[model samples]
Target: MQDPRMEDELVIASSPTDDGISCWDLHTGAEHLRYKLCSSPPHGLASVAGRFLASSQLRNPKSSASGTILYWSWNKPQPEVKSFPAEAIKPLVSNSQGTYLAGGGVSGDIYFWEVATGKLLKKWHAHYRAITCLVFNDDQSLLISGAEDGCVRVWSLFLIFDEVRRAEAKHLFEYSFNEHSLRVTDVKTGYGGCNAIIVSASEDRTCKVWSLSRGNLLKNIVFPSIIDAISLDPGEHVFYAGGRDGKIYIAGLSAPGASNSSYGNHIIGSMSEHSKAITCLASSADGFLLVSGSEDGMIRVWDTRTRNITRIFRHTKGPINNVLVIRQLQNTSPRTSNHTLASPLRRHGAPLPSPLEKFVNSADENAYVKVFINPHTTSNQHLDSSYITVQTMENQIKELQQQGSSAAAEVDVERLKSEQQRSLQMIQQWKTMYDNLHQFCVDELLDPSHPGISSGQPM
Candidate 1:
């Protein structure tokens, strides 16, 4: 069996003017599958758990037409599904588990959908202006969004779904940082969940790092030019900001170093090779490789440690706007002998999810209520487990009992009981193991054969 880690890494890039999405093998620089008929805007491309590719189409600014989102399976070059959203979507993001997808609309509204059912779970006015970027935190519990209004907001998914909490809270968002003076460009979250740092770039020629736990700005870095995209290093030591001046600036995070660079404080260094402005940036899993897409219609893979260009892929049709680094699909592997071929009779890989709803349906209120009663009952698999606790489950059971029991509610209560029992069993098992270890240590110390005691350590 082939190790999944050894699987090939693919770099996918899209352009606003081009009609196709380009894919290339990261290590070998060999071109792979190219999905056709996609004109993706900046931050519009998304990969759904590597099962398929999706991109929000760029519409003409003069046209009043509805926005379109297309999805393509791994083996097909053509889009399998097309969705018409109410307004043009500028940014699209999906959690690591691919269970939920979110899009930022030009109308300043955010649309969130369940990937499994294509149901619009929530739609709320997220910003005063169009949202420019959206990112989920490490645990997928909080969604951090940036808008053209120069504001960055952190939203807790738990509060968003709980109507009772939403009614009582002063604001839907947990934190709002309005430090930038111009349109915000990109936002990236670090590893820690509540304590993680969020880095946001803007046309104000500044990048600000905000603390998720404290809800305050941690570091504000001034750059020479507007930053369109930023990628956080895996180690959280430094982050790379792609500037309109065709340079990728490396800013220190936890690294113990004084900024001596001429650019500004926390500006450690830069990598410059692109002739035109950089449009997008993505860091590899190992933190050593960085992939950048530029307006010069080129994609450059850099070895960050060596500060050298490892490989370059050109997108000759148009300037690259979005870039993503994802693992190669297993079924699409070249070495697989039984690989299924793309056929007109049937699509390849997973079937396309249903089209996203343009508006929230009031008829789905029952479903929303169920989700509020038990967040885990829905298909939102990516929700952090820390949010669900034994006390929370017990309280939910009491509420359900007060509301009168149906078959569904009874089943949920039974499941919660089982979970509580399992947790108690686990605690007992851990305590027994600790007792055995303690007894063993006591026996060893009392034994005359013990080296230190027999030798009279004082002597």
Candidate 2:
């Protein structure tokens, strides 16, 4: 993908296909080596901060103690701590900045952990079935989770913590929906926390939105593909749902009491280029950039605005079941109260774009200016070096992809060379015309019938 990481390096995931986790670094499209986990059946994987990682796994349902959760340092080989009885086969996801992690169990319970302390801060019976998906808001006060029972729940962290601390916390809200045929596929909270809308994907081949405050199902969007995961732009305005069709779609949402977003509220763009399913998605604060990881072991970064691909999608060579974006030192100015801490985020999703580009940052909840440096560095030397590396690698990829294409559509080096020649010929013709026009404009006439007709089209 055309991401900064492709230059720095891509993250490659290689599990045993049953258990264990591995991270491979991409130097020139090939992995240098790997970071391995000793554990088996490691399903969920998430990047916490710049220094931490989190994961989880679900075992045979018939077994009582089959599910487990794990947390570790960025490059460390051992698990910091492992908890059992989690319900799903997916990895655990941390809060906005990876300081906190949340996972669901087969017992219909949700467990919360603080990464640094490895403390089981809270555990609650969240649903009646398997907790299939979960996500936290930017400020960590709100959480949205979905389950196999066709129920989506909104939780108030302030209340959960208050109840744990034995202090008085404001009353919280929760909402449930029974609108899908299969289990809840995935769930995500507001990216920038600019909105309170909770979005979820389901096996029913559709996505639904709920009001985190009132606990109401606001809209439902059906997709032609089975939505394996769903994500939102940082502005919360654009919602991206990805599925089996190997495409990610962008939709708008209606506020508290509007009609459908696609038909009534405010819904817009989408994208579908991957040949496989997209398991993970990440975006920057302004929602201008998006990074998506797929089952094909590719991670592509997109310019959501132009809807044109800008980068590579190879962070790994294995099925990347999960991905998260990490941020540090948030710079936000809050609107609610004082004492607002800037918490960075590891984004879970992104889609297409529109003209009225709005950002949905979870930090909007706390009002913090994200103090981040622009990632792009304009270096002529680096640019040349990067282009040369990319050209060589792309030649290899072209060979592979062409093999999969039909004969008429096949593209080989010879074809590229021929196309280059054609392009040069066109450039030469354009230069000749430009020269003729300039000479004609000053030299008066070239033909008997043609005077100073430089301000014109070709005869």
| Per-candidate alpha-carbon RMSD to the true structure | 8.3, 22.5
Q: Pick the lDDT winner.
A: 1
- The candidate maximizing TM-score is 1
- In the range 79-137, model 1's lDDT, one tens digit per residue, is 98888888888899987766678999887899997766666778999999889899988
The lDDT of each candidate is: 0.82, 0.56
Candidate 1 residue spans exceeding 4 A from truth: 1-5, 63-65, 329-334, 337-348, 364-459
Prediction 2 TM-score vs. true: 0.58
Q: Give the least accurate 10-residue stretch of model 1, judged by summed lDDT.
A: 373-382
TM-scores of all predicted structures: 0.80, 0.58
Q: After superposition, how far is residue 238 of candidate 1 from its true place, in Å?
A: 0.5
